[model samples]
Target: MSLLQSQVPGNLRLRSIDGTERLVGYSPPTRQNHGVAAVVGFEEQELLRDIKRALLRGVLIVGGGSLLALGMTLLVARRFIAAPTDALLQAARRWRAGDLAARAPGAARHSEFGQLAGAFNRMAVALQQREEELRHHAQLLEDRVADRTQALREANARLEAEILERRNTQTALLQAQKLQAVGQLAGGIAHDFNNVLQAVLGGVALIAKRAGDPAAVARLTGMVEEAAQRGQSITRRLLAFSRREELRADRLDVGALLVGLREVLAATLGAAIRVEVEAPPALPPVFADRGQLETVLVNLATNARDAMEKGGRLTLLAEPVTVAAGDPGGLATGDYIRVTVADTGAGMDAETLARAGEPFFTTKPVGRGTGLGLAMARSFAEGSGGRMTIASKPGCGTRITLWLPAMAVAAEPAAPVPAPRPGALPARCARVLLVDDEPVVREVLATQLADAGYKVTEAGDGAAALALLAGGLACDILVSDLAMEGIDGVTLIREARRARPALPAILVTGYAGDAAALAVGQRVEGSFTLLRKPVTGAQLADQVAALLGWRETV
Candidate 1:
């Protein structure tokens, strides 16, 4: 297409057709058939005049407006669709490549373009926020891992420490058992040997002065006496170990004992440590073995002294108390003599406290503590039908209480002291039947009776003794063993009484006697006299003479 120039004023030509000269009015014609050729016709002048007005007026204006509108619509459509589509593609690529800073132009003319801009802006903002959140989350995860690793390390360390502690505990326990075995052997050996030494010492002391120069005799006597004295001390400690000493249960003012023991506690603990005896006056009387109670006090005092190397306070307090029912110590509600030995020493933690009552448990270095102290005290306290308790905390003080339950009966008057030596023996010497399981024991007593000119019969066991007595063997005394395999001493006494109603019976046993014969008249449930074993020949003579009324002329 080409534009052509025409003679018409103010007209430009758009050329079109091949090799043809054409004039253009640069406008549309009103008449449908009118063309550029009509402008040259003189006879058709009226038609041309009409055509000119149409081209110069309405058609020209309308056709120019239509083309202008079409151009503007295309421009706007491209801007709205194409520009935004390119921006979205770029933004998506940047986001996938991990750049949250990527942004697109958001300015627009129309609402469609405006809405797309708004959505893109919001997407950018959300992406920025999510990126920050992801970074923070990663940091948090790293911190958590670090913390968990540290905790695991601490847990492993603790478990290792616990295992080592258990191993040490086991070693200590085995050592304690070894020491206990040694203690038992030493106690048994000492108990038997001490008696033999005592007899020797007594006989030697009786006669040494008659045979030597005064100085020599005095020196010899002193040496022998010292040996015997040391021997006695050894016996005492051994008997303590055996827990078979003479226990005389007396109504004792334990509060007073605490008061008295306090001074000794001070001496033991030294002036650096404070000693307090909290025992108020009028603490209930505790039926306890006084010697054993003293032993317990000394042991506790010694333990407290050892506990506080840096010197802390020691307190011994005895208070009358009623234990609550179902209390932690398993004590019942009743009058109790609560003897507490407390120390402001570095106390044990819970683990040690749990095993405190186990025999021979000690925190002290070897030889510093026998570990028998607590065990012996616990045994003696329980022997009187009472309980012992311990309460302690790490870095805090330890308080051990001996809870002794006493009989609640009002004090009864002392019964007439039955003379241990039977009142003058029955008027005449009667056929006396002696029964004992131990051959050495029966021989010892029978020799005395026969030597004293009384006919005596002996039997080894309950069955033999009963047979002889039942077969019409005339006997005045039925002396039987308390502990035998087939029938015990109490049973023997009952059977003999049934067999011979008039016969006097004596239940004798080695278990009944203390080292001292002070226990001659022990009668449990009171049917026969309980004569302790190892009675002196003289004591046997005295008892037999009193029973028969005839002096034993041995």
Candidate 2:
């Protein structure tokens, strides 16, 4: 191998021979055509040993330089990025844990970390401000709620007080209204009563002056009787208007009623207003209470007179009418007597007309009107199964119409005449027990009974009468006045009846209602009679005589 290697030049080759590696170099001749070569050979491991050592040195130096660069990078990252990141994370954690004051440490620097930290801090300040504002709003709301609750409580208390006061005021107003109505009625009554009293007084004075002259005395006495009758009529009218008297509905001739009311209307309306009544004689009779109808007519006449302040014509007319079912006037389907009272005077407006029949609604000045006139008239007409209507317009006068149910003519049974006894013998005188609380009344009644040929025993009161009866005083008839202080007439008569079951009794009372009630009871017992006062002495005598089966003398 050595001899062959000397032939090559500038060329080396590695060869493996006998499990050993060798390096071989070849050097060729300078000329291309020369075949001469030089060769050199060495072990391959020995030649590669120095080259491997140089490569190991280069690797060690490079590894050390890379490690130093890595260390520097780590240190710079820890100082510039990691520390700030850790601070931001810590601040975020603290803030999440409810530490609102916590801030990132790098916020003062001008780096990106500083900018992030500054933004985060700004967000925290905004959140804190929002939370405080919410708390302040909540506190204000709670305060307003409490204040509103207290205000409501006070208002409720004030409302209750106002209600109570209003109720009391209403009660007082109602009482005042009643008083006003009563005062108006009393004024009219006083005017009428004064005239009656004057007549009575004049007659009494004339009778006293002409006592010796029989004709003059008789005339004066008649005048006095007439005046007393007038007073009685006034009282009955007053009772009817006040609704104290019971209703006595009967068939009434509308024409006659209107004719009779003409004089009264003229007097009530004064001489200024001209009054006219036009009633058809053939008009059907109406079924209504006579007194109530009179009252209604009087009320209408007065209202017309008041409306005619400038003295206008007042006219009253009545006619027969027939109505069908569901009539516009709301009257029954039957014949009716339509009575109208019209006045050519200042009229009512629509509002006034609508409320014309409402009670306590008056157009007249406070003291001049009761306001119940039209209301009462309407009530009476409706109560009698009829209807009342009013028509009026401003400056067009007023007309009031009443539709009263017509009554069919019924045949009245002839009054039975008492049979004359055989030979017309005088009846036996009756013993009468007269009981009254007033001495003058008792004495006058006793004298009347005596003049009628009756044996009379007088007692001042029901108690005295009972005492006399219990003492066995013989009496065929018991006459007693109701409303006594002790043992009233009703009790006295009841006790007397127990002792004398067949004893005839006459109950005299000033109160018509009491007399009516007693009359109902007496009708059931057939042994008692009732007499309403303003009863004359002659009337009492006649009643006593009738009770005793005595014929009245001419």
Candidate 3:
């Protein structure tokens, strides 16, 4: 191997005896062909070196061709595929970031890639335009909804104002009718009251003249009492007719109420009118103010009497009825007591019947009627949760029917305990507190109490009465007028009761109807009894004795 290494110029070979191979190797100095020939046979080493050289040359040629092809392929891809694809990627990123104007720069290339970029830009533009259209439509719709809501609000406000105006007008007309009715009754009330006063004055004069004759004085006194009672009756009827107040509802048997009003109807209508009542015993009870019902009957009877100048028959018929929906009178579907007052007289025309319940609308001659009778009666019926309907025709009779709500459960008010006899009442030594606003009324009441043998204390107004009570003046009975300058009788009693919890009170008032008609009764606190004004001496004495639980000395 060492000999060959010194002698060889390229790949070396060595031959041994008998032509057997021994060594083969490579050397760096491959151009020394003579030394390789000396070490081995020339042809073999030379052939091997030639073969290696061919192999290296072939590898170099093939590698150079492959590198050139690869370079060409990369250049083509960068120009056609990579550049367009990169631009498309950049444009897509910008578009997603909401830049609608972003576009691939290679779009003008006039190839498939250019066409794709062009199509994508066109789609972006279409989407942007569609979004703008959607926004415009949404804005327009919102504006329309806002305008419609505003219009509805304005319409509702106008409707509410019109309703309020109609109600106010109705209230004013009713008030005007009430005033006119009161004015018409003024003349009649004065005439009747003057006659009663004359009788009373005559009786008193006779008693004064017959002072020494006990029987004559007693007889005259009786006449005076009768005259006073007649005056009270006239005033009561007047009050009932002219009362302008809310209804005080109570359970009442329609039959009993109609029967009780027969005498009043006869008196009001005179001898030319006959009143016939047909109320079945099985008629259901109703809820209404007793005084208001009486007033309604009287008004109808008066209207009937006026209609019949010569003579007429009035029939008051009552029965239970089940009203259905859409009834003729606009009554709600319910069980009701139907009270019909029919009169044989000059019937009303169609126009008159249509406007029957209108305030101050009357068919009678001017000044003969204020025209509030029918209107007020209808108003009362409605206020009591009922309705009044009129049926009439020309030359025929008129029937006014009142549909009143029947009481769900009929109840009887407990009767007031019987009062002690006047002679047996302890009129003497009972301390009394008398309160009134009017000087004359206060003086007269104080004198009457004093004369009744009671210890009387007087105050002119509710404030003075409260002050007296605050001063701790002990009182057995409190008699107070309702309307006063400061604190009213109701308030005074409430305050006074705080100090004397169980004090019995008698409230005297000209506003009896108003007090009774007030809806807020529970606010009054206690069961202080009410008495109407112009109370007689006997009535006053009896009330005071009863309140004190003291019987007069027999």
Sort every candidate by lDDT, greatest first: 2, 3, 1
Candidate achieving higher lDDT, 1 or 3: 3
Could you give candidate 1's per-residue lDDT for residues 1-554 as a string of tens digits?
11123333333333344543444444333234364322221223444788889888988799899999999988987877777778778877887898868876664535675677667768888989998999999999999999999999999999999989866875666567557545544554555466557756765765565565776666667766566554544444445434676668888777766665554445444567787878776556878887788778767776777788888888787777776778786667777877888898888898888877777677777544546667887898788778888899877888988889855657779888455343455523656677777787788788877776677888888888888877988776766667788976666766776655556666666652333442323522234455655455566655655555532322
TM-score of each: 0.39, 0.60, 0.53
**33-69 per-residue lDDT for model 2 (tens digits):** 3666665778888989999999999999999999999
* True-structure Cα RMSD, model 2: 25.6
For model 3, which pairs clash? 424-551, 424-552, 425-551, 425-552, 426-551, 426-552
Off by over 4 Å in 2: 1-181, 248-284, 289-302, 311-316, 324-333, 349-380, 420-428, 516-526, 550-554
Question: What's the lDDT for residue 20 in model 1?
Answer: 39
For candidate 2, the 10 contiguous residues with the lowest summed lDDT are 2-11
Q: Give the top-scoring candidate (lDDT).
A: 2
Residue 479, model 3: Cα distance from true site in angstroms: 3.6
Model 2, C-alpha of 422: deviation from truth (Å):
8.7
Between candidates 2 and 3, the one scoring higher on TM-score is 2
Better of 1 and 2 by lDDT: 2
Which has the greatest TM-score?
2
